[model samples]
Target: MATDKIKLEEIILKAASVGPYGVTDEEIRNSLPENVAPNDRLELYNSLLQRGRLQLKKLHGKLFYQTVEEQIANKLQALTAEERLVYSQIEGAGNKGIWTRDLRNICRLQQTQLTKVLKNLELKKLVKPFKSVKLKNKKLYMLYDLEPSVDVTGGPWYYNQEFDAEFFDILYQQTLRFIRGSSSAVTVEQVASYITSLGISKEKLEHGDFESLLQTMIYDGVVEKLYQRSNNGSSVAVYRSCRHFSPFATLGDVPCGICPVYKSCSIHGVISPSNCVYLQRWEQSLDF
Candidate 1:
């Protein structure tokens, strides 16, 4: 029995060694000797666990088996003392990422020192900087290999740090054109399918992306969201372009809308709303 147990452990370990990502239970079962019974195979797996040589974890509904060494590396040990501290804070926040000011506050480091540390970490490929779609001006730091959270990524409407403004505009117009050119009110799925048929990259365009952009257009009065009764006596949500829809309704509607110096035009800056030439022009136009 002792010799059989040792043999089973070796077989399992050998199978695991061959799997770079870790082996599944079925793989181990298949790797066992043909003469080995199912009951004995189950016992071997338990024996390996009791022997402390094998580790098991369930991920995404599958059991992954690996040796202790095959587990994740100690990420902190590879960094400098300050980098480790900053990384810990960033990793703690996970996909949400850490804001520049909050990271500085947590690390209690000078601005220059923090900037230098972040740059060094980025160069080492250990950490990276990304801007949130919700707040484009604020830079958030996250692990180099991790995806930003939905909140940080700003749903499917954003690509990288910048919003897909051009894509949104194109898609909005295309959707409106489809609705106006068609005889019937369009369903959400039809709009999504039409966008997909345009051959945009699946990674950049998703169903949720269409929903978000359409909702925004609806709120802006470019499209109308309505529910119509179906043949089954259930109401289905549909969209139609508003009769008064203006493609450029959002542009130049506010003072900042047409401001070329919008970036530098802060509330308390030299290029502020109070001293803006555009504002003055609009005010004079109102007087006339």
Candidate 2:
């Protein structure tokens, strides 16, 4: 009986080695010795399942046998139905994470119940909470093993859910310096390559990030964007220092002059002049 059990265990382990798709019952049976009694084979398979060494899963329309780590199986088995539901939702959200309110709405759980379940999951190290840079006050949840996406965390531009103004300022200065040092208008690709050569940023800066910085410089009146025809007859955007630009120029007193999102501001939009905090603050600071 002991020899038969060892042999069955080896066969089960071998079947599990096929990976996540798992093996069908027919495959497992074929791998087993023909001399083994049917009853003994069933008992051995049950023993492995009961011990959490193997798992039976139904994928598509077929049943398969897959191996699961004992600890993971035990942890999953120990979860309550509510905890499992919440965990699955968080897992489904992946690294981007799901907002707490969204999770509650999708799971159809009361705030208190959801909070309790989240606390339990956190205690078990199955999930963790993060703050979105765009919505700092709201909490987001994701699997503990997953890292938050750049969109959720605002990439390297944010720290602790707050915009790192100093970091932005440093990049701003460096980018402007590169543009001013150039003999003529430089293409966006050129500026990006220059920044990459500097090795100032630990995280890889995308081309769009550089473009955004250049846009902000344009807003600040320190840089000007121009379109030049390339050899292929395609128009390529280029940047150069604004020779006439000055910090104390005519538009210096107006907050709109340097607002990065100036183009997006509209009368009926979210960032309209009526609710423009910076403009209001500037107006209030002026001498009566």
Candidate 3:
């Protein structure tokens, strides 16, 4: 797989930059300096065809970008359709957390059958989580993206190893930029709602792509959880979307009983307040 017969690094870089959409070969070729001769391009292209190199291809009369998935698919053309489906789920997450139900919805599989496929994937050692927890009889799975397997030049390829924190950080930035700064609110649903209103039609969010992107944002420190206390104050409830780096940095380990700012503070109430002065700073901190 590491054969130097082809410029794998170059191909992978091109593919990684263009995934989610294909970049044509002509795009790559045209990116070359205006001074280059067309004959040189033709010679180089024919050499690749003659040598059976993987870095390039001619398709639909235009050169398009080939993502790491496409490269892998070409190399492992023998994999069964079921196997490819699992691989798609793994890549589709894009460093975000992936749930069995989300995967089922993405692949359009029945809920029961999705469970079996998830188990099969687990048994194969192809996917796993950094950690897992059960709440209210639901299983939440996280992805530990593998960076070691990444080529010297990185792309969205997953090798069997631990996920790199930096990759998650990038994904966080991407998702946060998508949300229009509304993630700072107290409710996950609120953040989600803000996004929905900005003309992100409900269908787009429901497409599983947006959800996966949101999951990655939450996993990375780019966005955070805004825990709401139940009226009884016995347990905390998670709102729909989540908290950004907004005010109340720590989410207050202290309940109102212990908060130093409890009595005189105009900040959060015994519970979190709707607005905070620190919010602007958090908003500015983002690359937006």
The numbered model that scores best in lDDT is 2
Q: What is the lDDT of residue 164 in candidate 2?
A: 88
Error of 1 at 142 (Å): 0.6
List per-prediction Cα lDDT, in the order shown.
0.76, 0.84, 0.47
lDDT of 1 by residue, 200-274 (tens): 545656666677877887877778889999999999989887877554455455677766778987889999988
CA error at residue 119 for candidate 2, angstroms: 2.9
Which portions of model 1 show Cα errors greater than 4 Å? 1-74, 110-120, 133-137, 153-164, 200-203, 220-222, 229-234, 243-288
- Give me the overall lDDT of model 1: 0.76
Model 3: per-residue Cα lDDT over 10-103, one tens digit each: 5434543564445665665655545546775555455443332323434567654444444343433544566557656665454444666667
lDDT string for model 2 (9-80, tens) is 888768876965679878888888888777877787788887767777777899888876667668777888
The regions of model 2 sitting more than 4 angstroms off are 1-78, 110-112, 246-252, 255-288
Model 2 clashing residue pairs (backbone): none
**Lowest-scoring 10 consecutive residues by lDDT in candidate 3?**
150-159
**Higher-TM-score candidate of 1 and 3:** 1
TM-score of each: 0.54, 0.58, 0.32
